[model samples]
Target: MKIGLIGSGDVGQALAHGFTSEGHDVKIGTRSPRENLVSYSDASSFGEIVVIATPWSGTKAAIDAAVAGNFKDKTVIDVTNPLVMRENGPPELALGHTDSGGEQVQRWLPGAHVIKAFNIVGNAFMYKPEFPHGPPTMFIAGNEGDAKVAVTRILTSFGWETIDIGGIEGARLLEPMCILWVLTGVRSGNWNQAFRMLRK
Candidate 1:
C-alpha cells in the first residue's frame, strides 16, 4: 500500500521507515520537499492511505493544505496529541475533556475515515517493539469499523496488541495515555519504559 505521511517530523519519518520496511511505499507531506519531504497534495495523491503526524498546533493547517477532499473514503491514522510546550515548564494539553485532536481531525476531514492510534505510546515502541513480557498494547478508536480494522491490521504487522476501545470520542481517554507515557520519562529520565496490559 502507498502511504502518505502528512508531517516531516519524527513521528512521520519513523512511520515512513516502518511502512517502507514492511514493503509499503511511503511519501512524507511537509511544507518543504527539498528537505526530504513531499508536498502535502502530492503525497496525498501518491498514497492509498494517509497518516496525520503534525504537531497538534499545525494539524488544522496541514490538513487544510493537504486538500481535505482528497482523503475522502481513505483511511487516515491520527497520531497526534494536543500538548503544547510552555515557556516555563512541562507541556500541557491544548484540547481535552470535551474534545480531542483525533475528533478534531475527523471534523476537519469529514469525508475521511479517521482512526486514532499511535498517540498513546512513544515512537520508539511504535514499530516492531520487543518486550521481555509481550507486545505492548495499542488502543485505537474510530467511527468507522472498517477503518479501525485497517489500522489494526497495520498495527499487528508492526507488532502490537490492539485493543479497540470504541468510537472516536474514546480519544478523550486515549490521548491522556500519552501524558502518562511522557510523564514517566520526564519524572524518571528513562525513555525505555512502555505500558502493557495484563489479561487472563
Candidate 2:
C-alpha cells in the first residue's frame, strides 16, 4: 500500500514509521520538503491512501495545496484536532459541540472517504503502543462503513483495539477527548497513558 502523509510533523513521521514497519510504502508531503519529502500534490497523487496529520490551523491550506481531486475515492485518515494553543496552560479546542476537525476535513475533500482517527493519544503511543494491561482502544468515526473497516485494519496493525463510534459527526466527541488526554498528561507529567475500553 502506498501511504501519503500530508504533514511532516511528529504525528505524521510517527505514523509514517509505523506504516513502513507494516510494509507499506510511505511519502510525506510538506512545503519546502527536503530530500526524501515531496510536495503535497505529488504525495497525494502517489498514495493509495492519504493520511492528513497537519496541525489544525494549517490543515485547510495543506488540503488546498494537495489538490483535493487527487484524493478522489481514496480513504483519507484524519489525525488532526482543532486545537488553539494557550500560553497559560494546555491547548484548548477551537471548535466543538456542533462542528469538528474531522468534519471540516471531509468538507475540504468532498471526493475523499474521510475517517477520523489517531487524535485522542500522543504521538509517542500511536504505533505499537505497549501497556502493562493490554492494547489500548482507538475510536474511529466515518460515514462509510468500508472506509472505517480499512482504517480499523491499519489500527490493528499498529497494535490497537478499534471501535467505530459512528459517522464523522462522532468527531464532536472524540476531538474533546484529545484535550482530556493532554490535560491528564499535564497534571500527571506522564505522557505514556492511553485510553482503553473495558468489556466483559
Whole-model lDDT per candidate: 0.89, 0.94
Q: Which lDDT value does model 1 have at 161?
A: 90
lDDT of 2 by residue, 162-186 (tens): 9999999999999999999999999
Per-candidate TM-scores read: 0.96, 0.98
- Could you tell me how far off, in angstroms, the CA of residue 34 lies in candidate 2 after the best superposition? 2.1
Off by over 4 Å in 2: none
**TM-score (C-alpha, index-matched) for candidate 1:** 0.96
Report the number of backbone clashes for model 1: 0
Candidate 2: the clashing residue pairs are none
Per-residue lDDT for 45-128 in model 1, tens only? 777889999988888889888999889999999999999888876678888899998899999999999999999777877898
Candidate 2, 171: how far from true, in Å? 0.4
